[model samples]
Target: MSDWEEDWDNGDSKATSKPYNKRNNAKDNSISNRSDESGRHRSSENRAPIRYPQAGEKRSNGQRHKHSEKIEVPSDLVGMLIGRGGANIQRIQNDYNVRVDLDKESGTATINGNTEQNVKDAYNDIEHHLNNGPGSRYNSKDGSSGHQSNAIYNFQLKGRNNKPGDTDDIEMDPSGVIDWEALNKKAKKERAARWSKLPELRKDFYNEDPEVANLTPREVARLREENNNITVSRVFQQENVSENIPNPVWKFEQCFSAYPDLLEEIYKQDFRKPSPIQSQAWPILLKGEDMIGIAQTGTGKTLAFLLPAMIHTEYQLTPRSQRKGPNVLVLAPTRELALQIEKEVNKYSFRGMKAVCVYGGGNRREQISVVKGGVEIIICTPGRLNDLIEAEVIDVTSITYLILDEADRMLDMGFEPQIRKVLLDIRPDRQTVMTSATWPPGVRRLAQSYMSNPIQVCVGSLDLAATHTVKQVIEIMDDGDKFYKIREFVRNMGKDDKAIVFCGKKTRADDLSSDLTLEGYMCACIHGSREQSDREQAIADITSGHIKLLIATDVASRGLDIEDITHVINFDFPRNIEEYVHRVGRTGRAGRSGTSISFITREDWGVAKELISILEEADQEVPIDLRNMAERFKSMKDRRANESSKFNDRDGNSGSRGYRGGGGAGGRGRRDRY
Candidate 1:
């Protein structure tokens, strides 16, 4: 692991497992298999008797339990056949009241149950999953998965051409393998049996929130000012939720009941007090109410929801080992953010809790191994998470706490569909907390669609705004003048200063990093085109102060935290104002002062109006030339709006209008985070 990955560690949490080995992870970055049906990872310890049959367990007559013939599971298919953390196998055992175990060396499985029918059903279930491995892409009738060929049991591929350079060894065969309807019936039975054990929803856990009554409008106004313009209102209705709101926690001791581990994390991280968002969010969230936290970038949003999740997951009635799947699911927009959240989760020593970060570019097998090791929280990006869901590596149905960090960014990255798909499987009553810097229409639509009576806690104005601590400096110049302007700023840099330069394109970032290096200025660069590990290294280099300068595109704009970063230089302004806010907000983090320099050329005039608005909102100096450019763009926009019918963009994402429109690329307002 790079130092960047471990930089935040204070060794406060009892880490459940070590990071996955990277030796063979190169080949397996994504799960090739996907299906709507999924199962959960579980351990044998403390599992209900309905799941695993004990040794010598038999019918009332005291006869020996019937054992199914050993199934020869291919060595490679064992993981899926048994499911990650033995979830699939455990599902089968619970459904049929059977005992199933895998022999890794022998590559075989045995199923023992009270009746022959139970053993046979369990065997068929494993066979079905084994059959539906990555190689089998096509489904049979009713969109149901097909089983593998009988020859695969012996590690032999049937109908192999053995042609040179042919890598595909497994093939799909949909020919009737088992009674699909009968298996469905067994699955339904198992689901019902398991859900019956779910603990009742309760807000009055040992750790309690300050139960306060309704606040007068005047009191609310006063409270908002005190909490940095934070506003809390119920958005929907839930049976268990209270109309009476809870007061925000000013101190860590006031929020948690008796969690010493969490306090230890707070102390280790040197968090003197809760940020505005955390202060209010912690109270509402700890009260078990769905919440939407709107806060500025780098205002301690991660810990706001994370700390509450620790309390909820650990204090639940079910033990971590006995749970069917993860208790919490945090949907992040990017892998960097996902890994960052995982790091935050790792910093606390809270009840031996574990969390895993799964994304598209990381090793799928290694992720599966870590998840199997047992994790209560699974923090992941949408795409890879959906893939894992399809492969049954994760089961969201058991998840009770759900968080959508940067809900706007997730939708902007075109992850709405995936987010919705993931949400469909999760329980409706799960405590959901969504945090976004701005309250956009799309985010509102999503919250309305899924969340229970959510208490929306807005830390600042809901409008799109940059970090107020950063001093914004805008220079309107020719495109060619940008290079020299950035050079002058870099030359005047303080030794302790760290800066992140933003470019519009990946190639531009690479070129900038190279030209600067040749000019005797060493720097790291990152964008979407680089390998996952390489991108991580670049971030690590800058984060660990191994390098004082870094260049990147919009990829680094969201959910990246380097508190000491002194400057943000917009070498090439982003296409949209939303991205520009994210870029400049990268600096001036964690209550620190910073500076942002943007060289805005005529070509970048489209976003000028919105740029001026952001600058004015942050009380930063806006150059006269920049103001003139915004007016010019506004006139140009009015002219274009009147010129042609085709000029009317449905989302108006061409420039400053994009911010007002509050959408992306005529799709999910998502262009690309990378």
Candidate 2:
């Protein structure tokens, strides 16, 4: 016999000498005698009779009987609960002063004791053993507790919380004492109650004007069909909105009549209807609510926010002499974007509202004079705006409407401090609107810090990838082969086809432009280092068909709308996927088909997986070589993560002696082999 078996037998003998054990022995003898007298019929009387020992009965025999509790154990856990030859069961019975009887066929264990508390304690012990396995001890305070049962269940269900080759799931608590199902039901009820109180959409009400009436059912159906067919998607007043806010209008004529002159201007521009961004952003801004507009490039985001600002200013117009400063301030990231916005401003700046553009490399005195001459709208870059504000040439205290265009680009170009300074100097109750092509973390932080209860409006999926309107051609080649490939592509193109080649550095652009021009190709270059006049001339030449080929940096990637550009070439990959999206967006404007080609090399391995994912999502054909490179990169990344975790587990510090002696050398060896 094993040591545990011998000890258990001796324990039973020692226990029989005690008075309580003696009383239990006598009761067992009486039951056995009754069973013998009943013979084979005893099997039919399996149910035990309920008996409650009174105080008087306890005095007679120095013992008492209480109610018995039955607990069903899982069939697989029967052996672990009973132990070898039933030693563990007997140990629990002796320690807790209870009777534990197991029905092997049904897997039911009935525990009886002198009191209810004793029965509960015995059941708790049995549960702990079953959960922790056969090696676990009874009456041990270190076992699983009630609070950790839910976490344990979740761990088991998920099969190793995070990574493979990990046994962390088995280490969680296994007490099984908590009622998880009841808790989950209660949480679901609370969620349902919260959703029941959400605001309902009032589709009939058009605007706050009392003259507009609710639309009929037939009209509503027609409007919905138009919206769906045109792909105009919108989410209105998402969070913390008042109950009285109305749904957005579908047609430009439905809402544009409030400003008849603006409607006339729209018709004069040959605009048939509002774009998706305009259709959604108009009503929210009209209601005087702060908003963040997210849409793809070349989708008319400029006019989306501009028209509403003009309408609001026209509604609260005062005499020119009485106006303190510009009523609306539009901030752009680049001088080119600022100029474009100013041009659009002129189209809708009717009704005696003057608009001016301010940027660097322009005459500072002239900009100062324009601001002093009392314009209703001022469009400028962040740097020039900050300079004018510090110079005290412009007063922003009276500004009521603030707009930040290309907001993500501004944050990317290290303009946050200047943007924040201008925001701080403006009026406290200004209705701020921010528009971006993508919503990175920095843009979200800026919105939370400055705006008040802003509504987010996304016109389409928020993907920082090139649109399907542009055909993407990906080529995997070495750095030395890029020039040869570009030469071949340019020779194959028609003489009148316009193309813009993008490079990573200013010096590279200048060098490439000089080489191409010397080789008898009409090419020009533009970057931040070039004079503003030179850059302006380059853009003008490209637009007027004087220069068919242009090499530039990321400055021209955004907000420069050239109409008939047929193709875009990325001679060098961009810093990220977002920049790549903008660089290719220069083409595919105004519903015209275009093409973009990229030269990806081995140095671009870090972003290979992301590039493949973007192309896949856009339904573009991916090259086989790039797919293999992405797979290799993923495997390398996962291996490094596993090695780092192992090192951290061995020693708290990665550079510790133990880790260096073990995982560090192994990692170096693996890298060498690779």
User: Which residue pairs come into collision in candidate 2?
Assistant: none
Backbone clashes counted, model 1: 4
Angstrom error at residue 89, model 2: 82
**Decoy 1 TM-score against native:** 0.68
lDDT of 1 by residue, 269-337 (tens): 887888888877887888787888888889899999998898898877766677778899999877778
lDDT per residue as tens, model 2, 1-674 = 32112211221111111122333322211111112212322321252332223222322334556768888777767766655444456546645668776665666788878878768877877775565553333222555443254244434444211222232334323542344466577556755665454322111212543223376645534543554222222223345545343354656776777677778888898877777677667777877878888877788889988887877666654544666677889998877788788888888747888988987766767888888877989998776676566556778876778999999988877678778878877755678899998988999889988887677877556766676788888999766777778888877878768999998778778878887787788888987777777888998899899988889888888878886888999998887888889988898886777899999876666678888877887799999998887776667667767888788888876732322211222332321100
Best by lDDT: 1
Q: Where is model 2 poorest over a 10-residue stretch in terms of lDDT?
A: 28-37
TM-score of each: 0.68, 0.63
Task: List ranges where model 2 is wrong by over 4 Å.
Answer: 1-246, 642-652, 655-674
The lDDT, on a scale of 0 to 1, for candidate 1 is 0.71
